[model samples]
Target chain A: MKIVTCIKQTFDTEAKIVVGGDGQISDEGVNMILNPYDEYAVEEAIKTKEKDGGEVVVVTVGGDKAQEALRYSLAMGADRAVLINDPALEKADSHAVSVALAKLLSDKEAGYDVIFAGKEAVDDGAAQVPSRLAAKLDLALANVVVAVELADGKATVTREIDGGTEELEMALPALISAQKGLNEVRYPSLPGIMKAKRKPLDVVSLADLGLSAEDVASKVEMVSAELPPARKAGQKLTGEVDEVVAKLVELLKNEAKVI
Target chain B: MSIVVCAEQRDGKLSKVTFEALSEGKRLAAASGETLKALVIGSGVAACADELKKYGADEIAVADNEALAAYTTETYAAVLAAYIAQESPALVLMGHSTVGRELAARAAGIADCGLVSDCVAIESADGDYLFKHPVYAGKAIGTFKISGATRLATLRPNVFAIEESDGAGAVVDFAPEIPAAKVTVKAVNKVSGDRPELTEADIICSGGRGLGGPEGFKLIEDLADSLGAAVGSSRAAVDAGWREHAAQVGQTGKVVSPNLYIASGISGAIQHLAGMGTSKYIVGINKDGEANIFNVADYGIEGDLNKIIPALVEKLKEA
Candidate 1:
């Protein structure tokens, strides 16, 4: 069995982010890391390989800085890595990115038995890529998969639904997008980190994939970003506990009318 | 110009968001100088057509198909696309719920247009419609202009005010040339949550990691029970495994616009604010006065939630 995982790099959430004078987002010396959701995808991919005895490949479309994200996946125990990097791949929207990936995956080597990705990226929160990719690849796709049992040449998938979950069986060569709490993430040991550097990583530029920068970008561009207006802090309520409670009840019943 | 509003109904009854979308569509139509139209689909569900008219729809397009009895991507999209292409409405509007977000892109895909999902406020500006979307979760705001002539947008429910009437307008039966059997629902599994439906709740009580554990939600539930409010959670609570993601309120979770939002033990992260920041009124209960939740809170209570919430719940019961 062969599995492929899609990953991306995002601002390290722990870092303090700031908006500069030019209205651009600057992390103010904060570090960058692989998206946490994608980490779950990587972990699930590795576990699937361990269960079915297959090779796991981590694919990332990012910049020179993204190499570190690829390295992180390798450190966590992927068998191979592929970087679709180029100056042109920047700011690719969900649709174009899925197209570029589907073209590359289809026209490239190694027929994959399964593909996995996170439900959505933290930055954009556009949960369209996985479904779009599956549509483009013409693969039997399951979006937002929470659990899976790959056996008997078919994968029984458990998907989250309104107030509950559903179970379905799909044949091999399927696509699945993972969500958090699906599996426990493993930390890379010292030896695993060392072995990561020697792991096989194939770096391919966007040009090599026969796609130009425009093919992967949104026809729409984000010219500027700004913050929402903050509401005035509510009048501070102070007194003994009962008094404050009385004030709150008055507000809810009279002023706010929430109750 | 004509506005196409997707009327979302459940079990042959109209969802509140349906009226919200209808209200928004009416507003958009009046703004754009157009007539408001509606599209209804389902199995044995012709009764909802008359109710939709009272909400402001002038012309209602009915597609009675057994396939649409339940929402399946293929069935809904195919029928919706057919209606959209035929009518060529100036804009299409749907409730900015989870199902709305999921279908927005697919609808845009079929229409070959761009979509601005999760829009809080929308209006026409400079001969183009401007969509106000929150960026950086709820920490920021940005305006988007869709160059597409047939604009698509999903508005957050409960944010828009709903107007009711006794007027029932013209109902036209236009059979969508599509078979429902083609799109198999395959299977549906749902969890039965004890909490009131978060999206439909008029008053919401959400807890954060400050609550300490899953047990803290019990106090939240107690308060909510007293107030007849839905229980929700911050991402910290959801990520900490104290609550389900469905109950999460933030940029990554469901965006809510309840009349009243109460945050207990939540420090108010930007991501969490993005989800419920648009509520009509927000009350923050936290020990830290400097907590960001206070920035948008209409009432700030600086205290320990464990001690304060119980007292508040008791007060509500007494009231």
Candidate 2:
């Protein structure tokens, strides 16, 4: 089984999200981090390869600097890296990006039994790619997958819904968007990082995927940026623990009405 | 032009969030001087059309197919996108639900519009809609204008009150131009358990690092169980391995706006506050009076939650 994992690069969670004059995110001088959710995807892909004896390819749709994110993958343990490096694909919305990804996978004729991605991207947190890719490629998809296993030409997965999580059994060659706690993300060992540098990293362009700039133009654009208002700082009560607890109960019942 | 609101239904009943979307549609519709319409889709979900009409919809589009019998992104997006195109509503209001987020992202792509997910506030100023959403895991908020004639957005549940009205409405069975077969649902596997819906739970009890470990959290769980509330945790609690990230309510985790929120040992970092600052009532339990959580909480108890929680739970049982 060949597994393809989609990893996205986002500003580190701690970075100050400076909205530049153009209303786009200012990435200059900010520490970059892989989307937290994608760690589970990478982990799942490596685990899949370990279980079913297949190669795992880590791919992304980002700028040239995004190669560092791929390097992080190498440090951890992905077998290969494919960066769709073209000015055309940058800032492509989930829809256009998914179309480009589907076309890329098909053009390569990459035989894979399963494709994995995080439940959603961390930057926009749109959570769109996995399902949209499934629609374009016409494959089965399960979003919010917690448990996944492949066997005998089929894959069994468990995911979440409004009520709760349910188990599912479907045939192979499907897409799944993963969530956290599915597995523990592993760290890159010294040897893993060393080997990652020598590992094959394929760079694909939109032209090579047989796609055009127009096909990947974002339909929606960000107009402006502003911050949320701060909550009014409240007063704190002082007393013994018992008095504080008693006073707290009175406030909740009388003022907050939570009881 | 009229507006369309998608009312989500589950277990053969309309989700309370349906009212929230309708409430927003009601506001936007009234502002634009247009009637509000509702587009509803589910398996065996058409019976809910009449109830939706009373909420302010002038017309309801009911699409019931076995394929849609379950909530899959493929089936629901195609179904919703086709309906939005047919109606050409000025605004589309949807809940920021698990299904709503997935469906909204796809629909925005199909309709060629932008979506502001997990929004806390939507304001109409100078004939443009301004949306407020939390960023940086919840320490700060970002407001932006969606530049499009057809504005589509998903509202965070419970942030805005679900508007109510005595509007008269009717059901209209309309077929979309696109065939349902245009999309395929290869498989669906949902998690099934007795967990309450996190976003909509009126009362949420969350634990944090102060709880020590998984065993210590059982007391909080017991309190949550007695209150019949959803369970949540702070980033420290999740990092400490006391709870799952799904159960985390903070900036990096799920943002929630329940009516009543209880935090034990949560110091109320900006990220944690961003996720739940919109909660109407908050109770904090910690030993520090200067904890940031007290800044937003309606009430505070500077004490050990381990001793305070069992008593609170017992008090509730007596009441």
Candidate 3:
């Protein structure tokens, strides 16, 4: 059994996001970490390998800084890491990113029995890359998986839907995106961190993957950006709970007209 | 030319977001000089066609199949892909609900087209469409322009107004040969709640970690019941095991734009605000005046939720 996990780096959830003067995102003085959800994917991939005696590979697409995310995955227990980085690929949309990933994974050297990824990157929240990559690879895919059991060339997956849960069975050579509450992620030990520094971290380009500039062209273009408008302050009702409740009732009936 | 809208239904009932999608589809099709068509795929959903027709759809296409009774990425994608491949509509529309989140990209991927998800607004300029959506957890808005043979977009629920109408239109039977789903849905445990869905509710009352424990939601639920509103919770409440994930309203949770949103004991994170900030009216109740929830709240009541909620529930019950 061979497993490959897709990962990304994003701003820490607590980081204050600010738009620069040029309408581009400014992450100055902010901490960057592997996307929180991807941690679940990496943990699941490592755990599966620990149980089934297989190799785990972590893959990422971004600039040089993204290699940190790859190393973090390696530190967590992945055997090797692959970085698909180029200046031109920085602003690529989800579609282009999927194309590049599919191209890279299709390599005979990158043969994988199963693939895992976070349900969505916390930054873009697109939730499209892994599914689209599965489509491109022509593999079965299940997103937002909470539990997975792989055996006999098949995977029984449990996922959350609108109201409840659904148990799905898919053959191997499948793709799954990890949702939260999947598992508790473990921190990298000092020995693991030291070993990760010596792990095989291969950086590849689009040309290396047999992809052209035209093949990975972004379909969605960012036209503009701005901070969301500030919400106006609402009137505060003081006094006892009864008074506040009385006032709220009157306001809902007369002003808001909701009740 | 036509603009295709995927109408979502569950258990033989149409989702409100489905109507919202059709409304936007009508506007976009009119702007682009394209006909609006609604496509529903499920078991026994032929009756849903009339609702789409009344909401301004020019044509309603139903792919009634037992295999599609519940959503699986493969079956829905294949059926929708088959329809879009044959029709080649200028634009494809769906609601950015759980089903849409799973179905939209797969269909677009199979159709070999581009998609923008969770769009709050769509603008047409010279027949080209530009979509506005939130990124970076709703702290900033990004406008996207997609260029492809066919365009796909999922509209955020409650962002678009549903058009009023009383006219039923034509229905066309679309029998596509759906392939066997690679993934099988064994069972579905539907939520047992009489309150409206969080995404489609007119009024929402959400609680947060300030309630201290799971019991805090009791007050929240009581107020919600009295006002005929849906119950919501911040991610903190959900993560703390105070509420179900389905009731979570935040960046990772369901985005809601209800007519009235009441936040109790919630210290708003940007992620939570991103989900509900678009709401028409926001009321915040927290002991701390500095909670970020107050920043976006239209009405701020400084008090303890434990007392305020019960008192409010009593007042409503009396009224």
Candidate 4:
């Protein structure tokens, strides 16, 4: 069994968002880390390898700084990493990213038994890459997956839906996106971190993957980006507990009309 | 050219978001002077055609088949992609839902077009359609313009209004070839509750780690019952195993914008705020007066949630 996990680097969840004068999001002074959801995918991939006696390889599409995210995955027990970085990908939309990934995975030598990815990246929250990649590669896909079990060349997956969970079964060579509650991720150990520094990490350009600027050109253009309006300061109610509760209820009914 | 709205139905009932999508599609079509078509694909879903007509769709196409009784990404994407290929609509609309998020991208990929998901607004400026959506987990907004012959977008639920107008349209039967499913559905386990879904709820009552334990959710449930609202939990509460992940509200969880949001015993992490910050009116009840939840709340009650929530529940019941 061979497993491939896709990951991305995003601003730290606690980082403040700022739009610069250039109409672009400013990354200055912002701490960047591997996306939180991708951690779950990496963890699940490694766990599957540990049990199934195979290798876990991590893949990412970003700039030179993305190697930090690949190294983080390596430190978590992935065998190696592949980073596809190029100027053509700077403004790539979900379609372009998927095309690049499909090119890489479609190579004759890049045989994979299963693929894993986070349900969505926190930065864009597009939640389209996995499905789009699956479509391009013609692979079975299960999104927002919580539990998975492999047996007899088939995988049973449970995913979260609108009001409940749905169970599905797919053959091997399928793609699964990790949702939260899939598993608790483990922290990289000191020995693992030491070994990760020596792990093989290959950085390639889009041209190396048989893709050109025209091939992966973004279909969607970013017209503009801006920060949301700041929320107004709230009115604090102070008094006896019962009085405040009564006042709040009245306001909800008469003022807000929500009740 | 026409605007095509994919009407989603489950177990023979059309979803509320479908109506919202149709309403938006109708407006966009009227603005562009194009036809509006509603496509319904499911087992025994032809009955939805009449309802689509009432919502101002100029044409309704139903592809009723037993194979589509349960949603399999491949089959549904194939069906929708084939429809788009034949219709060649200028724009396609659907609800940004579990099914929509899973199907729209694959359909767009097959149709070889551009897609924007979870859009809060769609506007036409100088004859170009601009899609505005929250990026960086609701901390910022990004406006996108698709440079494609045909574009697709998913409208966030509850953000768009649903309007009804008496419309006469032709009902057509579409018989696109459904592809073989790569995945098979085995079972479905629905959460047992009559409360509205978090995304569709008009009001929501949420709990956090400050509630102490899973038992504390009892109070939150009582409050929600009184207001006919949905129940939500902060990531801390879900991580602590006090609530299911489905009920979690955060950047990694569900993003919602209900009419009223009550945050009890929540200290409001930035991630949690990213999910519910856009809600219309927020009420925070926490012991810490300086909790971050208070910053974005419309009304703040500084006290113990254990006492305040129960009192508020009683008052709501009376009101």
- Whose TM-score is greatest here? 4
| Candidate 4 colliding pairs | none
Compared with the true structure, what per-residue lDDT tens digits does model 3 show for residues B74-138? 78888989999988988899988777876888887777788988899998788789998888777
Model 1, residue A56: distance off in Å is 2.6
TM-score ranking, high to low:
4, 3, 2, 1
- Model 4 chain B is weakest, by summed lDDT over 10 consecutive residues, at B161-170
Expressed as tens digits, the lDDT of each residue in B192-250 for candidate 2 is 24657888888899988878788878888888888788888998989887776678887
Highest lDDT against the true fold, candidate: 4
Candidate 1 per-residue lDDT, tens place, A78-164, comes to 998988877776766666677677867887744998898887676656566675576556566565677877888777877664445
Evaluation by TM-score, superior candidate among 3 and 4? 4
The better-scoring model by TM-score among 1 and 4 is 4
- The Cα RMSD in angstroms, rounded to one decimal, for candidate 3 relative to the true structure is 1.8
TM-score of each: 0.87, 0.89, 0.96, 0.98
TM-score of chain A of each: 0.91, 0.92, 0.96, 0.97
Off by over 4 Å in 3: A27-29, B166-168
Docking class of 4: high
Q: What TM-score would you give candidate 1 relative to the actual structure?
A: 0.87
| Regions more than 4 Å wrong, model 1 | A15-17, A20-30, A86-88, A138-140, A162-164, A205-207, A211-217, B164-169, B173-195, B209-213, B251-253, B269-271, B287-296, B304-307
Least lDDT summed over 10 consecutive residues: which range in candidate 1 chain A? A216-225
Question: For candidate 3 chain A, which ten residues in a row score worst on lDDT?
Answer: A102-111
